[model samples]
Target: MKRRGVPPALLDAFLVLVALIDTWANVGFDRGAPLGCALLASFALVLRRHLPLTTFLLTLPTALVTDAVFATLVALYTLSSLNRHRVLLGICALTYAVIDFLPWPWSNLRATELAGTRNVVHILYSVASAAAPVFLGQLVQARRELSLRLSEITEARENERLLTAQSVLAKERAQLAREMHDVVSHQVSLIAVQAGALQVGSGDPETKSAAATIRRLSVQTLDELRHMVSVLRASGSRPTELTPQPSLADLQRLVDGSGIEAELKTDLPGDLPPATQRAVYRTVQEALTNVRKHAPGARAIVAIHHMNGTIGLTVTNTAPTQAPLPLPGAHHGLVGLRQRAELLGGSITSGPTSDGGYELHLELPIGTT
Candidate 1:
């Protein structure tokens, strides 16, 4: 985790206070040029961040006139940390060293005379002092750069991980779509073809009607399967054409083709929305389907009406006249219907009635539909 440091304002104040103390110790409050330059250098530290070069120039006069060197060293460090030009930093450091090494009365001194061992030692110490702050500042700048690069690297890795996961999911969906096309569609097509043949071959009126009904249902199932396969192949990468759905207008046809005695009594507004109409139609279809499979020979009533500000849909069936035969079923029709209703901001409640029958209720707000 990254650690927080002192606030910028507070740190700047602390630096100025330290500079003032250094000024007082080396160049006391004497009425002279040395004291004035020292005071200017100490306060110039305030401009180090915004005007680092200017701050260094202001502090140079203090280094030449007095022994108070803390503010000058700080100004040099600040310039080094903020600037990328090495030549400018080198010139500043060398100037600082030379200024601090020469004594007060050096007008008569020559380079050959300064070749003494004591003079050389003092010059070396001054150079080292000037170089210390530059090195520390460079280290700080490098650390800040490294932190930024690490954050960028972490973000790139997260994006790569998400892309890899999506690729795997797309592959799985493609495989499923292939299986549906190759196996399920082929089987359903054969059912439709056989039902067609039976309808034509049968001579009895009732048998022919039954065969026709079977063929119609088989063809409908094939259409839905084809659409589902196309959707799986798309893998949601782009928009796929929506299959035509049954609205309120198709409700009567659905009940007639259900192969069950179902009555659809609707007292609804003429301006019902497509989504609400679809939901109601689907709920009634599922209810009648259940009555046919689980409650054979039972009569069903589908009632849809507007009550208060809500639209109410109810499907109820009487008790079966005979025991139903065992049949394979996925039992997902009602669950799917309830989920669809909920998606449309509606609710569904379904259970057995006290008269030994099944009933499903759906309620939806007119405004939300």
Candidate 2:
């Protein structure tokens, strides 16, 4: 385990202290030359972390003369841990072994005295002192590299999981769009055809008007449904050719076909954007559909008022004279209209009128494509 709370400077000072004590014991401090070499070797420990090779070279001469083993061991450990240069480590280890084993004029006399009987023990001690620190440093380096690799692998797995989830969601959305186009579109088209036939066959003005409203609304619903289906199918692919969306000009055909007594009032620009025109057309269609379904035989007034930077639409119906038919309602028409308006940075509201009828109001920003 690594020591905590001990700063590097303090550790270096401790190594130097240990080296000084060992040098004094092995080679007397009374001799100026041997004492100076020992002090210089110990001082080199301060440079171990920043300049390990320089520190290792400085301690070689002292290791040959006196027993300044602490400073030599610390310098070797720093060189192995920080530099990671195998060639430099091999050269330093060889130099240290030669210096430690070879007899010299300034050699530690007490250690050299057991040269005959303790030769093997002396060799093992010298090798262990030199090799232990380097081995420990390499182990530490290996552990750090393993931890980094594990972290990178974990991050890659998480990213892959997120991408898989997104792909599944996209596939599900596309499937739903296909189902709506195949099932709901066919039924809505049938309703429009039946309403058109009813309008032609009915003799009463109220019945004809109601039938006409249903037909127009059904057609508009189909158009919007087609657009939604196309969008879902496109996903990330190239756009497919779509039918031309209806605009304000198509409102006349809608009103005429509605078979109801309805009036449209507007002075909209001839060059209004396509999106704005579509929104206006759909809003009117939904309101008329509600009138046909809930208040049959009611006269509807559609008023489009253009103001500075905004377009306002109001569809108001008088009280009904005939009862509503028991036709199946999807019940999502008004919710869809509200979502459409909000998407264009606009709003829509509808409620019962005091005159026992219903009214819907829409405010959409102009130039919003």
Best by lDDT: 1
lDDT of the structure predicted as candidate 1 = 0.88
What does each candidate score in C-alpha RMSD?
A: 3.8, 7.5
Clashing pairs in 2: 209-259, 212-258
Question: Model 2, 35-145: lDDT tens per residue?
Answer: 777888888888988888899888887887776666787788888877677787877876787678666774444754656757777777777777787877677777767
Clashes of each: 0, 2
CA deviation > 4 Å runs, candidate 1: 1-10, 24-59, 66-71, 85-88, 103-121, 244-259, 270-282, 321-327, 336-346, 367-369
Question: What tens digits encode model 1's per-residue C-alpha lDDT throughout 242-317?
Answer: 9887788888899999877888899887678888888888888788878988998899999898988789999999
Question: Model 2, 135: alpha-carbon shift in Å?
Answer: 4.1
- Please give the RMSD of candidate 2 to the true structure: 7.5
For model 2, state the Cα shift of residue 53 in Å: 8.7
List candidate 2 stretches off by more than 4 Å: 1-137, 174-178, 192-261, 266-285, 304-313, 326-349, 362-369
